[model samples]
Target: MLFDKIARPAMYRLAYHDPEVVHERTVRLLGRVAPALGPVSRVYRTDDPVTVLGLRFPNRVGLAAGMDKNGLALKAWPALGFGFVEVGTVTRHAQPGNPKPRLFSLPGSDGVINRMGFNNDGAEALARRLAAHGKPGVPLGISIGKSKVTPLDEAVEDYRFSLRALHPYADYFAINVSSPNTPGLRALQDKAALAELLAELGRTSAELGGSTPLLVKVAPDLTEEALAELVEVCLGHGVAGIIATNTTLSREGIAPADAHLAAEIGGLSGRPLAARSLEVVKFVHECTEGKLPIIGVGGILGPDDARRMLDAGASLVQLYTGFALHGPGLVRRVSRGIAGRPC
Candidate 1:
C-alpha cells in the first residue's frame, strides 16, 4: 500500500523524465545497501519451500531475468523476499545495446516496453562478480543470449561461450532465444535451429557433468504449432524445464491513453501480457502432460496472477515489470499470499 500510494507515484513522475535512469540509480543504491539491509529483509521471506529442477526454492515467487542483467544486486533479491533470481541475458561479448530511449513506460496500461537488446557487462564479468560477492541465499539462474554481432548460424557457439563462462555460478541456466529486440534472435526458435542450439548446449551440459539444470525461455508470440515444436526440441535435448513466456511483439492490450507509444518496436510486458503468457503456460503444461516443469513469467502483477500461473501448471513464477512498478513490498505480499494458500 505504501509503494502504490507514495513511492510508485514518485517513480511515475521520474519515469516521465527517463525510466532507465531511475532504474539504474535504484539498482546501484540497492546494491550498495543490500548487505546492511539483509537482516531486516528476511522478515519478508516466506517459508513455503518448493523444489523444481532438482533445486529447492524458499518460495514460489522470483525476480525474473532482465532486472539484474549483470547480477549487480545479487544479495539484495533474497533480502527483498524473492525465492530466486534469474540474472543476465548476458552474451559472449559485452556490447552497448540499442540506443537511448530504448526503454519506455506505459503507465496508462501498467506495462513496459523495452528493447534493451541484452545489454550487460558480458558473462565473464558477471561470473567474476558472483565469485567475488558470493551467491544469494536463494537459487540463481543465469539467462544467456546470443551476442548481437553474432550471426544466426553461429548462435550455438555464442550461447555456448556464455554457458561455459558462467556455469560455475549458475544453479540453473535459462537459454533465451525468444527476445524480440535482437535482430534474427527469435528466428533461432524455429524447430531445426532450436534443436541444433539445444543439442550443442546439451553436449556442453553433459561435458560439465550435467549438474546445472537447463530451461528454455519462449516467446508468447509463437504460433501453437511453433510452440509445440519448440517443446519437442527442448525435451529431445534433455532440457529440465521451460519458461513461458518472454515479452510479446503484439500490442493487443495497450490502453488508449498510452496508444501514442504503441508503435514503439519492442516486447510488451506486465498486465498486457497476463492472458497470453498464462495461455502459453497452460498449453505447454497440457502438451507435456505435466512431465516437464515450467517457470511461468510475463505479466504477473500480484498474488492472484501468481496463483493462476501455478494452477495452470507452472512450478514457479517470476516477476519483472511488476517488481519495477510495485517495489519490494509486492514480493512479500505475493510470497505471503502463496504461502497461505493450499498447495
Candidate 2:
C-alpha cells in the first residue's frame, strides 16, 4: 500500500520520470543498504526451498537479469527475498550503451521498453568484484551476452571469455541471445549459431570442472517452430535449462493511453507479455517433455502471474519489469505466495 500509493509515485516522479535514472539511483541505494538487510531478509525471505539445475533455491522467485547488470546489489537481493538472483546481460567488453533515454516506462500499460545494448563494466571487472565480495548467500546466475564491438561470428569467443572469467562465481550461467537491444544478437538463437555457441560453452563449462549449469534466455518474438527448434538445439548441446520469453518487440497490447510510447524501439515487458510468456513456457515444457527445467520470466507482476508460470511447467520464475514497477514488496508477495507450491 505504501509503495503503490506513496513511494512509487515519488520514484516515478524522479528526474521527470526517466526510468534509467530511477534505476541507477535505486541500485546505488540498494548497494549502500546491503549490509543492513538482515532484518529485511528475515521478514521477506520465504523457506520453500527447491532444487533446480543442481542448485538449491530458497524459494521459486529470483531477481532477473537487467535489474543489476553488474551485480551492484548482490547481498541486498537475497535479503529482499529473491530465492536466487541472476545478474548481468554483461558483455565481454566495457561499452557505453545505446544512449541516454534508452529505457522508458509505460505506467498506463504497466510495462517498460528498453534498448540498453548490453551495458556493463566488462566481465573481468565483474569477476574481480565478485572475487572481492564473494558470492551472495543465495544461488547466483550470471547472464552473459556478446560485446557490441565483437563481430557476430566472434560471439562465441566473446561469450567464452565471460564464462571463463565468471565461472567460479556463478551457480549457473544464463546465455543471453535474446535481448533486442544489441544489433543482430537474436541471430545467435538460430539453430546453427546456437548449436555452435552452446557446443563451445558446454566445452568451456566442462573445462571449468563442469559444475555450473548453462541455460538460454530466448526471445518472446520467436514463432512456435523457431522456439521448438531452439529447444531441440539446446537439448542436443547439453544445455541445462531455458529462460522463456525475454522482452518483446511487438506493441500489440499497449493501452490506448500509452499507445504513443509504443513507438519506442526496444523489448516490451509487463502485463502485455504475460499471455505469450506463459504460452512459451508451456510449449517448451511440452516440447522438452519436462526433460529440461525452465525458469520462466516476463510479465510476472503479481502472485497470480507467478502461480500461472509454475502451472505452465516452469521449475522457477523470475522478475524484471515486475520488480522495477512494483518494487521489493512484489518480491515479498511473490515469494510468500508461491511458498509450499510444488516445483
Candidate 3:
C-alpha cells in the first residue's frame, strides 16, 4: 500500500518521467540494502515449490529478464519473494544502445514502450558481478542476445560467447531472439534461423558440461502458423523450454488519454498485452501437447493474470512491467495467490 500510494508515484515523477532513471535508481538501492532484507524475506516469501527444467522454483512467480539486466540486485530479488530472478539480455559486446528518450511510461494504460536495444555491460561484466556477489538464493536465468554490432549471420557465435562466459553461474539460458528493439533480432526467430541458432547453442552447452537448461523467449506478434513452426523447431533442437510472448509490437489497447504515446516505436508490455500473451501460451501448450515447459510472461499485472497464465498450461510465469509499476507487494500477492494462500 505504501509503495503503490506513495513510492511508486514519486518514482514515476522522478527526472520528469524518464522511466530509465527510476529503473537505475531502484536497482542501485536494492543492491545497497540487500544485506538487511531479512524481514522482506519473511513477509514476502511464499513456498509452493515445483521443479521445471531440472531446477527447483520456490514459487511460480519470478522476476523476468530485462528487469535486472546486469544482476545488480541479485540478493534482493529472493528477499522480495520472487521464486527466481532472470538477469540480462546482455550481449557479447558492450554498447550504449539506441538513443536517449528510448523508454516511455504509459501510466494511464498500464504499459511501457521501450526501444532500449540490448544495452548492458556485456556478458563478461555480468559474469564477474555474479561471481563477486555470489549466487542469489533463488534460481538464476541469464538471457543472452546478439551484440548490436554483430551481423545477423554471425548471431550464433555472439550468443555462444555469452553463454560460455556465464555458463557456470546460470541455472538456465533464455536465448533472446525476439526483442523488437534491436534491428534484425526478431528475424532470428524464423524456423531456419532459429534452428541454426539452437543447434549451435546445444553443441556449446554440451561443451560446457551440458547441464544448463536453454529456453527461448518469443514475440507476441507471431501468427499461429509461425508459432507452430517455431515450436516444432524447438522440439527438434533439444531446447528445454520456451518463454512464450515477449513484448508486442501492437498498440491496439492503449487508453485514449495515452493515445499519442502509442505511436512510439518499440515493443509494448503490460495490460494491453494480456490477451495476446495468454492466447500464445494456450496455443503453444496445445501445439506441444504439454510436452514442452513454458515460462509465460508479458501483461501479468496481478494475481488473476498469473492464475490465468498457469491455467493456460504455463509451467511457470514471470513479472516485468507489473513489478515495475506495483512493487514487491504485487509479488507477495501473486505468490500467495498461486500457493492457494489468502492474500
Candidate 4:
C-alpha cells in the first residue's frame, strides 16, 4: 500500500532513463536505508526450514540474480529480510557489457526491459566476497553465465570455470544458459549444447562433492517442444531444481502507450510476465508429470502474483522487477503470504 500510494509516484519520474544506472543507484540507496528499518525489516524473514536440492532454505522467497552480480551489498540484505539471495550472472572473465542504455523501465505497465549483457566483476570477485562472508542466514544461490566475448562453441568451458570458482560459496549453483541478452547464451539451451553443458557440470559438481543443488534457469519464450526437450535433459542430468524462467523476449502484455526505449530491445519483465511464467511453470510441471519441482520467476509484484505462481505448482518463487518497484515491503508481503500457505 505504501508503494502504491507513495513510492510509485516517485519512481514514475525516473522511468525515462537507462535501467542499469537506475539499478546501481537504487541498490546504493537501499543499502543505506535498509540498515535503519529495524524490526520492520524482520517482517520479510521466515524461520521455516525447507530442504530443497540438498540445501536448507530458511524460506522460499529468493532474491533473483542480476540484482547484485558482484555481491557488493551482501551484508546488508539479510538485515533487510530476504529468505535467500541469488547473486551474479557473473561471467568467467570481466568485460564491459553492452554499451549504454542497457536497462529501461516501463512503469505505466509495471515492467522493465534489460539488455545488461551479464556485466559483472566476474566470478572470482564474487567468490572472494562469498568466501569471506560465508553464506547468509538463508541459503545463497549463485547464478553463473558465459562471458559475452566467449564464443558459442566454448560455452561449456566458460560456465565450468565459473562453476569451479564459485563452488565453495554457493549453496546451489544456477547454470544460467538462459537470459536473452547474451548473444549465443540462449542457444546453449538447445538439445545438443544443453546436454553437453549439463552433463559436464554434473560430473564436475559430483567430483567436488558436498551436494550443493544445481538449478537451470530457462526462458519463458521457448516453444512447448523446446521446453519438453529441456525438461528431459534436466531430468537426465540430475538437475535438482528449475528456475521456471528468466525475463521474457515477448512484448505482448505490456500496454503499448507506456512501453519505453527498452521496449524496442531486450527481455520484458514484471506484470507482463506473470501469465506466461505461470504457463511455463504449469507446462514444466505437467511434462515432468509432477516430478521436477520449479522456482517460478517473471512479472511478480506482490503476494497475489506470488500466490498465482504457487497455485500453478511452483515449489518456491523469486522476484526481480517486483522487488525493485515496491521495495523491501514487497518481499515482506510475499514472504508472509508464503509462510501462511501450508506447504
Q: What is the lDDT of residue 340 in candidate 4?
A: 53
**TM-scores of all candidate predictions against the true structure:** 0.98, 0.98, 0.98, 0.93
Residue-by-residue lDDT tens digits, candidate 4, 1-343: 7866887667656656545656787677765665575666566566655766666677778889989888877656766567788889899999778878777777778888888889899988888877775665567889999998899999899988999999988888888988999898899889989999999999889888848788999999899999999999999988987998998988878887665444468888899889999999989988887677788988888888888888888988888898887777787778777775654
lDDT of 2 by residue, 1-343 (tens): 5778888888888834577888998998999899999988887888899999998888999999989988888999988889899999888999999987898888888898888898899999999999998878999999999999999999999999999999989999999999999999999999999999999999988998998899999998999999999999999998999999899998978999889889989889998999999999999999999999999998999999999999999999999988888888999999888888888
lDDT of 2: 0.91
Residue 208 of model 2 has an lDDT of 88
List model 1 lDDT by residue over 1-343, tens digit each: 7889998999789898899988888888889988898586767778889878899988989999999898888888898899999998999999889998889998888899999999999989998998899998899999999999999889999999999999888999999999999999999999999999999999998898878999999999999999999998888889999999999999999999999999999999999999999999999999999989999998888889998998999989999999899888889888887784543
- lDDT of all predictions: 0.91, 0.91, 0.91, 0.82
Model 3 lDDT tens row, 20-41: 9899889999999999999879
Say what the RMSD of model 4 is.
Answer: 2.0
Report the lDDT of model 4 for residue 23: 74
Number of clashing pairs per prediction, in order: 0, 0, 0, 2
Cα shift from native, residue 138, model 2 (Å): 0.2
Error of 2 at 48 (Å): 0.6
Per-residue lDDT for 228 in model 3?
A: 91
Q: For model 3, what is the alpha-carbon lDDT of residue 147?
A: 95
Against the correct fold, how does model 4 do in TM-score? 0.93
Candidate 1 collision pairs: none
